[model samples]
Structures are given as C-alpha cells and as structure tokens.
Target: MTIRVTQPGLSTTVQDLGRPGYFHLGIPISGGMDRFALRAANLLVGNDEGAAVLEAVFMGPALEFTVDAIVAVTGAEMTPKVDDQLRETWTSFAVKAGQILSFEILKSGARAYIAIAGGIDVPMALGSRSTYSLGGLGGHEGRALVVDDELSLGQAGLGAKSGIHIAPKLRRSPGNPAELRMLPGLYWHRVTDVSGRNFFDDTWQVAPEADRIGYRFRGGRKLEFVDREQPFGAGSDPSNIVDGCYPYGSVQVPGGTEPIVLHRDAVSGGGYFMLGTVISADMDLIGQLQPHTATRFIEVTLEGAMKARRGRQNLLDELRASLD
Candidate 1:
C-alpha cells in the first residue's frame, strides 16, 4: 500500500533512530527530535520502536491513504484531522482507504511524529532510515515531504490496532521552561572561573535560529572566558578552541554569547569551545522547544547522567510492557 501527499506540511520527513557510528565521517545522526514520542507513536501503531515515521515540524502533512491503515500522532500537539474530522493525538486512529489525514494550526511544541501501522517503507542508509537533509543522505530521497510524494508501507505489526492511547503522564509535554540536564565538557575549564557559573545561573530562551542541527538560546548573561594565551591553532576569540570532535548534545558559545546545543543533525567537530553537553536522556526536551520558550540547564554528575539514562531505558521498557 502507499500514501500520497496532497499537502506537505513544513519540514515533514521520514526518520527512525538515525544512523549511528558515522559521526567520525562528518555524518550526523538525524533522527526524530523526540525519541520518546517517536517510540510511543510507533508502539501505539504496533510498529518497531525504530521504525521510520513522519517527523513533522510545527505543522503536519495532508496524506491520502491508498489503503485503510492504523496510525498514531505523537510529540507536538498539532491538531490532526482525518478528512476534516478532528482526531485525538497520542492515540491510534483508523483511516479508511480514501481518508485524508491533515494537521491544522500548532497548539504546542515544535515538532510531531506520525507513525503508520507498518513503518513508512523507505530504503535504509548506513543501517538506518533517518533523514539527514543537509547531506542529502537518508529518508525519502533525503528531503522533506513534498506534494505528490508517494511512500510505500511495510508489513504492519500483528499488534497494530486502533484506539490505543498513551497516558498523559507518559507523554512528553511541550511546556515552556523545560529543565534539561547537562555535564561539563572538555573545554569547560576555559570558561569555568569566568562565566561558566552564569551559564547555569540564568534562564535561557530558545532563539529563532534553532533547527535540527542545533538550538541557540538567548536571555543569558554574556559568557566570559578566562584570560589566557591563545593556543597555536585556536582562533583569536576566547570561545574558540583547537578544532575537535564534539560529543552529541555539546553546548558551545561563540563570542561568549548565545549558548548553542548541538543536536542530531549537528556537525561532528568544530573550533568553538564546548562548555558542557546535555545528558543523553534529556536531549528530547531540546527537540520540543519552540522559539522564545524558556529553558534551564541543571548540571549533573556523570553518575547522575548514567542513572538518568538507565531510568529512561527502564521507562521505555515499562511503556512497552504496558502497551503489550
């Protein structure tokens, strides 16, 4: 079966867990911004947690299903509708063979996930089906959904059923002022004594420049750096370091202003000094942020980060069990 796009909403693309183990080659891991929501949506539709689904930004696509299918909408609270009939998000809904699925105005959050009964059958690149648009790498032709695009459907999971819903508490809310956890990075010492403390001392707002590659934040005190002789290859700016690999979720500030958190589609390495990195477990919160949304980064120990990671895995396990 296939689904045809009548109106492709802003930045809709096919994504799974994204390609890993390729950052060293300058390839980004461009998966869904909110993995938790993606997993939830997939589970609701009885698809594998890593199945490729539609990752829509702000708005969603209008799709005409060629065959009756069970689907779910998760992540952002964009109002989803089937042939103009309002449909509840975070729950599975059935669509008739000719029914049209469309999304209206955004109610909250910056992105949303749409999972079909079976995953959107796209060719995998580098062991994943996620789209890295910048490099024109994966997904449906490595680009956002466009009008007239027809996507094939994989075999539906045996458990694919309509009307399944995830609990409110289990859903990732797009509420403003989200608290994200971070761990100090390699160049943290360069700013520690000067203004590193201020990075956490003030609340930050997501900037308009935020995207899949990274999120730039505003409303924080100007970050200052400790005075020191510049390294040979480091740039003149205090915020510049010798170009080096940046871990996923690394936070870097250029010219000591506007802290930027690197995301799934971010470049592998750069010369900018990294102050800290958002913990792996809290990265999803970054994906849900809208422009002007407030955010706070709480510092955490390595052990605390590990604990949070374990907790997230356990929560996924529990969610799967409950759904099963």
Candidate 2:
C-alpha cells in the first residue's frame, strides 16, 4: 500500500493513545492531542481505539492513496475534502485508490483526527508509537510530518466491505466548544477565597502558547499565589512524596499571574502550586482548544471526582461488555 503525503499542512503527525508508565523517568505522555475524537474515529474504522491516527493541527496535509482504504475523520472539525469535494467528519468512507484527500483551514477546534481501518505502521519506542518531539523519540523521525512523507498501514487489518457507511450521529460535529472539567489540586488551600471564586466563575480563552505539550489558557482573573508552596509526591499525587513526575494537569500560577493548566504532555511533577487537575475524562477537550476559544474549569471535590471516575469506568465497562 502506497500512501504519499504531498502536503503536510501546518502541523501533522502520527499518534496513538500515549506513552504511559514512564512518568517517573520524566517522560510525558505524548500521544493524540485529542484523545476522544481520535479514539472514536479509530473505533468507527474497526481499528482499536488506541490505534495510530493522523493528527492535523489548524490544517492538514494532502494525501494520495495508492490502494483502496476505509477512513474516518474526527476531533476539531476541519472541512476535509476528497479531490476538492467537501466531505464529512466522524463517518467512515471507502476511498478509491487514486483519490487525493486534503483538509483546509480550521473551521472549528484546533486539532483534527484521521483514522483508517489499519493503524499507522511505525516503529514503537518505549512501548508507544507517539511522537515525543522534545526528546526526539517516536513518530516520523521524532518530528512533525512535512510534504512527501509516506505512511503505510499496519498488518492488523479490518477487511473492508463494499458500501459500508456510518450514520451522521456517529460523526463529530464542527464548532463545538469544549469545557475542561476538573477537581481541586493539592494546593487548593493556597488560593484565596475571592480568587477561587473568580476561577470557577469566569471563562478563559486558549492562549497562543499551546501545543502537544500543554494548553495554556489566558484572560481569566489573575490568581493570587500564596506564600506557602509545597512539593508533590510521586506515585500519583497524595501518595508517598517522591520526586514529582513530569507531565500531568497542573494549574500553575507563576508570578502570581493567570493560571496555565498543563495537560498530558506536561511535566510529570511540578513545583508550581497546582490549583486543580483537569481530570482524565476532559483531557481531550483541553487538547482541542483553539487559541482565543473560551473554556471554563469546574472545581469538584475529592468525593465528586471519585464519583466521576467510577461513572466513567462504568461506561467503559459497558463498552467492553458489548464486545464480550
């Protein structure tokens, strides 16, 4: 199968779920920027939810397929077109062998997800197929995709049937706003009552300084930092206090200025007092934020967080149960 990239848009790369279990060594979980949409698109194409998919940020590359393939688009919706005809997102389609697929400028969120029946074939580094650009690890030479890159699918194929298509309900819609749901962080006590109130009351716009590493939000009320700052423990906060891990959700208020909520690719542990964590369920939402787009962070109690986790676990259980 020949897949050639004639134009690799503003920024495009291959990403799977993420690289986990290495935070202790200060490795960030660099994977699909928008996990939900990517996983959903992969699922629709009969590929595992965590399969490698193409991540298009702000724009996308033009692809020329040499052989037949089934594909789906998700996440921040960019009007993707095949040979200049406007196409849709989230729904799987059978593309003929010589068709050229291209994505225009962003019509909605920041990143777009493209998944095919077979996962993107790439050599795994440290048990993941993600691109860690900073460390020069996995992905296409540990960097973003440019024009003329060739991609081939994995051997784990889902046989494509004739005329199979998905419904509109399964496709991701464009221009949908994403909110970051979160729980109080370890330094929740350090925030003043008034600042805390403003944090939950107002919405912040995505700052220009955002990427696979983290989404930095601005325009919210300037938070007052406390004189008391403490260290974060290792083994998933609130546990034994070891050297903090590298990347995680940390609402860092540096210089007593606006908070920057770090996401998956964030440093494992941090010294900046954490206001709260965005939580796993909403990380995808955080990742899809467009610069200047509005977002609100809701503060939940520890009990509420546990409930949310359990609820999400139940949903996953049901999904897995269906397969069983």
- Per lDDT, the best of the predicted structures is 1
lDDT (Cα, tens digit) per residue for candidate 2, span 40-78: 767667788898888888888899988787888878768
What ranges in model 2 sit over 4 Å off?
A: 161-178, 228-247, 310-324
Query: What would the per-residue lDDT of candidate 1 be over residues 122-172, giving only the tens digit for each residue?
Result: 998999999999999899998998999999999997888889988886776
**Per-model C-alpha lDDT, please?**
0.90, 0.73
| Global CA lDDT computed for model 1 | 0.90
Off by over 4 Å in 1: 192-194
User: On a 0 to 100 scale, what is the lDDT of residue 248 in model 2?
Assistant: 70
lDDT of 1 at 181: 92
